[model samples]
Target: MGRYQCHLLCRWFFTQSLCSVIVQQRKTIDYSAKQNLLSYATESSLDHLGYMTDTPRLEAQSALTTFEFRLSTVLTGAYTIPAGTQITTGNNVIFQTDVLTEIPPGSLSGTVSGHALVPGVSGNGFLPGQINALITPLPYVASVSNLTESNSGADQEDDDNYAERIQLSPEKLSTAGPEDSYKYWTRTANQNIKDVNVYTPAAGTVEIRCLLKNGDIPSDELLEQIGNVLSATNIRPFTDHVIPKKPDKVDYDISIKYWISTDDKSRATLIQSEVNKALEEYKLWQRSVMGRDINPDEIISRFKNAGAKRLEITSPVFTVISEIQAARERNIECTYEGLEDG
Candidate 1:
């Protein structure tokens, strides 16, 4: 009986000591977290560190579009369209004129620069004819409509992106037009840009390809914005020609068949859910970075870890992605071949 009691006491003491060691290790990890690395630093720590780099988090920007005001008939004199003329898309998004403009007596319409009243991405993607409803009425103004698609609306920068820019801030100081310098400045143009590829296509020509979040291609307006940033007198080298373009996208498909062991039949439903989620995560990981190779091995590993007993992935062979190209998924097909005996 005494031996059994001692055994119990020893187990209890060991458990308590292990717990204390774990607590101490955790405390040390928290205290010694790397503040300089983007992956290890907390958001608050990154914000505080950004001051040293002069990289403040990017704020949301209003969408810019052109608004055209039409007259029912040619007026006898030039009709002035005042600034602050409110126009709506018939939805919640509103746009207002940026400056005072006049429609000449012989002209049937006049166009003025305008921006969305609300900032951020919500005001973007309106079609050319979408903003047709005039909120602030003016005399003899027959109609108002946007002449171009709304664009340039961007959300505020997230913590990870802000941290990345802070890390890349040193590259912005280069005057000789290095690749990293172009990348650093291009990213500063908009918060929506996900990946940037910079290379010299010719001796004096610099080509920049940018990809947006979720592998969306950069719009013309965004490319223009990036061009403007890189073309600034201080940013661009006198001998270099900078051109911003879209990344060349390599397309691939995914088709997978998997089976679960019969012994684990009860957990088949749960494992199937996990497999689907893993597939989605894999797709995102594959396209999140520029020049990420399309590897079936990565898919196999993720699927197997997600409780897939055995799987066959047929479509995505190992393809090397070029530095100026991105991989985009075209189709996805996942099939469960039912349970197989172990």
Candidate 2:
């Protein structure tokens, strides 16, 4: 009683109205049929690529800088020679050679932050009587590439590991059609023609418009039609027998929009029913087995995991939080005030 404040009413009313609109829009909006296809995820592209489905990968851009330096008086520190020391080509011409008892020679070194030099003699010896200095830039800075950084390509190996781990099974594939089926017979009997059934993974999206605003939730038959269209395309997995999952649990991602109108609580039921109907049809979208028998348990298990079977909602008024939780059973997976955990 203490928590049931007046301000809660306004917030509650607003939330309900907003929920109603979101659900309604989801029920009515047609995303699967939209043709403005600029880009798509690999899953979506499976439809166009057929059984030869391709997966997406990451790529990197290359960035490298080219650096250069010249051994000259202005760049290197200046050193004057005795104007007449014809240092021979192979020997003294090189800097830091076996020199006289006391002649000052020039030198060079590389720095990480400063301009680097290629490994080479900077300048050479004295030319007596010439009044010219041979600036032997002893060691110009070395280019970054020249240094042995010794990277074992750990990043490359990691990327390759990911690629190897990604299972690249085709989204669309064709095996021999059912035994004695026309597709099977025709392809098997004829060598000239290939058994390529133009396969496309189904693309399904729903727009929900509030039924209360429209006077009533759609009829069961109309809802059934929606289900049919959603599941008509191939993609949904089907199995002949139930497969046991080792972990006994699964992870999932889901989004929901709903409109709440107290004018008729019936609308919520109607929409939920519609969703169930659609899902039932989707379950039937198994690949054609032809003459081969299929496993029933596998099909059932797959159906459960493939579609979103639960509905959840939250309350704007915190006062009735417990009541909303009570309205939905734990098994039913309903939330009244919190967002779904990713």
Most accurate candidate by lDDT: 1
Local accuracy of candidate 2 as per-residue lDDT tens digits, 1-342: 345665698789989989989987875554443422223213333233322334232222111111112223233343332222221223332111112221123532221111111111122111221212223333332211112111111111122222222222322233222212222222211111211122112322222111111111222222222234323234222321111111111112222233334443445466445545543442233111111122333333432343333333231111221100111111222222222232
List TM-scores for all candidates, in order.
0.78, 0.14
What is the Cα-based lDDT of residue 25 in candidate 1? 94
lDDT tens digits, residues 1-342, model 1? 699999999999999989989999998887667765567766677777887787777888788888889999998899999999999988788999988999998899999988889889899989999999998979989999998898878888888788788888999998899888888899999887878888887899999998877777777767877898999989999999988998888999999899998988999999999999999999889887888999999999998898889988788899999988888999889999999987
Output the TM-score of candidate 1: 0.78
**CA deviation > 4 Å runs, candidate 1:** 1-44, 64-85, 97-114, 125-129, 136-152
Model 2 has an lDDT value of 0.26
**Residue 328 alpha-carbon offset, candidate 2, angstroms:** 66
